[model samples]
Target: MTRPDRICVGAIAGSFGVQGEVRLKSFCADPEAIADYGPLWTEDGTRSFTVKLTRASVSGGVGARLSGVATKEQADALKGVQLFADRDRLPSLPDDEFYHADLIGLTAQDTGGVTLGTVRAVHNHGAGDMLEILGPGTKSALLVPFTLAVVPTVDLAARRIVVDMPEGLE
Candidate 1:
């Protein structure tokens, strides 16, 4: 996928200290891998930034200094700026491994080929990842575990996900 289709890997949460380090929140499974991708760009494909991890912070995110940001004010101005990397630079996934971007637009279908919804987001809270699938008529989003029992097949090429929805989920 091109940069436009690239997945969001991290975000600038503003400066950590008064010196120059900026607070960065990584969306990657391996948080430190955010720096491995180098030269992250903005959603508009206009601004690009290079991150240098300075230190680990007590808070969940890391402390980093952007290439062009030398002052605290400069870092503060970039608060809430999301960063994206070229999809090609990212490592290929194993049989079960998946990129969040690949699952975002996939159509969720039941075993009988009934359409459940499209995957709107993927989230994990120390536990396994959850597929946030949005049902066709339902206003509330459904959270399905990203496991073989729940999500049996994830065919990215076909742009669809075969999910074995639990008892009442269907």
Candidate 2:
């Protein structure tokens, strides 16, 4: 379950060194800004941490120390822990851009106005964003490239998206 008040900003990639520093994989547009959104909370909201960035890690992530985590073992145990920040603390995006969270659960439709599916997830595997949609009567999910030509319309207020399905994809 996702909280509307919070947004996931980063994840712990395990201990960076023998010290208390942990390798952090930031999902922010400005990766270094992850530390600015301090007091990040765990998924279940049971735990929270103040981030202090130390340096950049070799794994393309930043090395950071979490509040109350003061040992190699302590940092190691927090591997894969996702960190979320209060939505209010984040900067607002321009009209053309959207947060991944906002895109999830939106209804997807074809250019002809036929119902396709609901967006189950938004993925970016180094290239660009893709929308994962699961429709009725289909056993598999549909992966649509989130480009302006493919997805011409996104009506967040209506909770729907207009997609121009590619010929080979259909």
Candidate 3:
């Protein structure tokens, strides 16, 4: 069963019409599938909403109506509010792929097996995924490219990652 500790899948982009519809931006692989994961929850899980897609959005998202939002004012209030779904509700990944949640918190080790740091977060800025490693006493986290050449192994069972640091990375 998917835990109630939801993983973010989408967000509200502001109201779409006078009839209480809002612009929804989905982060799912299939953008339209965002409505299938309902009822979506707030980050803290204190609130939830049933998402019903009405049509395509004009502002780069989809038009949708959220439960309890019956007026434009009501829908507009949800702008920027993120939507989350139970983790297990998400599709299973292939063996070579991984969810960002699964990669966080793993210990990072260098080629010589030296303990480097813990994985803090993963970021993707249109280029590729990058791992944020926070080593002890470091003022800033080390950003490592999550490439096959650099990250040769990710042992989820062992909660560790084997990294072959490129020159100047150390």
Highest TM-score scorer: 2
Descending-TM-score candidate ranking: 2, 1, 3
- Report the lDDT tens digits of candidate 3 across residue range 1-170: 22435677889999987999989998887788999999998877788899889996457889998999999999888899988888777888887778777898899999899989999999988799999999988889999999989999999999999999999987
List, residue by residue over 1-170, the lDDT tens digit for candidate 2: 55878899999999988988999999998888999987899999999999999996549899898999999999999999999999999999988899888899999999899999999999999899999999998999999999999999999999999999998999
Q: Please identify model 2 stretches exceeding 4 Å from their true place.
A: none
Q: Candidate 2 at 45: error in angstroms?
A: 1.1
Please identify model 1 stretches exceeding 4 Å from their true place.
1-4
Q: Which ten residues in a row have the lowest lDDT in candidate 1?
A: 1-10
Error of 3 at 59 (Å): 2.6
- Model 1, C-alpha of 4: deviation from truth (Å): 4.4
Please give each candidate's TM-score: 0.90, 0.96, 0.88
Q: Please give the CA lDDT of all the candidate structures.
A: 0.85, 0.92, 0.88
* Winner by TM-score between candidate 3 and candidate 1: 1
Error of 2 at 133 (Å): 0.6
